[model samples]
Target: MMHTSVGWHVEMEFREDDQHTRAVAMVRLPDGSEVRAHGHASRHQTDVNQPRVGEEIAAARALNELAMQLLTKAHGEIDQASGRTSHPIHV
Candidate 1:
């Protein structure tokens, strides 16, 4: 992959307190503009036990939100460049 297309990077970090996890995504557009997405996940339990099902679900949701945000931002940038909108045509 070329450096140009590789505009986004994903980072996931787990905190030591309250099973908190954070995911940050950063992207650079073609116009040399940068955007960021942030998501935080947390579990209630204090133990390190393989992340319970609910915890996994929460983490997944957080990551999904972060991904969607980043993609939406990128799509917006592209749409602006191409002069497009989210509205559909009426027949």
Candidate 2:
């Protein structure tokens, strides 16, 4: 498993399998904002109905990227609504 962060936060996992692999991403913003995303992909030698571990990772990365983009947009909206200075907060 690996942890990644952009405007939001993301997590990905890899497993050994000939079938499809699964991945998930999550994001939390200020003021208790939260969102989640997921992806799955098939691998070589695996049925199209199933995804490989690498494919799963790739899907997860894509989902995370989307989450980050959403967070970035939402963050801007939140800051604008609250009229708060742009600064990273520890939570």
Candidate 3:
């Protein structure tokens, strides 16, 4: 019998520009693999200039992209282990 434990860490950073907000999200895996995703939100001419709102939107988008990346990685691993190509997994 074999047993293993794994852990990962997630970090996010938001940057504000003159008319846009950018967010970067990173995931660090136990095997030293790092996955990164980015998102951006632009202020519209008629929309309110809310820093918090931009940050929230950008962060959410970045996290969503990160989730998809992680899922894809897992699916690829599963395919390799199974030794057969399977349909792409959707989140």
Candidate 4:
């Protein structure tokens, strides 16, 4: 029997404007495929001006979206391997 271990590196970037913060998350797989997702957070009139909070929220949302996309891709691959039509699989 044999075992193998694999790893991937994920990166994230954040940008901010006067009223909004944007985040992008990216992952590059060993097979040269890349997955990326974006998320944003907006400041309201009543909200306190907090840059760190905005960055945290935006980055978390972007990572969440990225995770969902990766799960969807995995589900599609599984369906193809099993000779079945791809179906929406909620995570």
Question: Could you say which candidate leads in lDDT?
Answer: 4
TM-score attained by model 2: 0.44
lDDT of 3 by residue, 1-91 (tens): 8998876777889999768999999998877799999989999979888999999999999999999888888888988999987676575
TM-scores, all models, native as reference:
0.46, 0.44, 0.84, 0.85
Instruction: Give the CA lDDT, 0 to 100, for residue 8 in model 3.
Output: 71
- Residue range 22-63, candidate 1, lDDT tens digits: 555455556776655555666657655444443455456556
> Cα deviation of 69 in candidate 1 (Å)?
0.9
The deviation in Å at residue 39 for candidate 3 is: 0.8
lDDT of 2 by residue, 1-91 (tens): 9997646445555443565565656556655755665666556563354444466566656676655667567678889999985654422
Tens-digit lDDT string for candidate 4 (36-57): 9998999996988998889989
lDDT of 1 at 52: 46
In model 1, the runs with Cα more than 4 Å from the true position are 1-8, 16-49, 52-58, 87-91
Better of 3 and 4 by lDDT: 4
Off by over 4 Å in 4: 86-89
Sliding window of 10 residues with minimal summed lDDT for model 2: 44-53
Q: Model 2 off-target regions past 4 Å?
A: 1-8, 13-16, 46-56, 59-65, 68-91
The true-versus-predicted C-alpha distance at residue 43 of model 3, in Å, is 1.0
Give the total clashing residue pairs for model 2: 5
Q: In candidate 3, which residue pairs clash? A: none
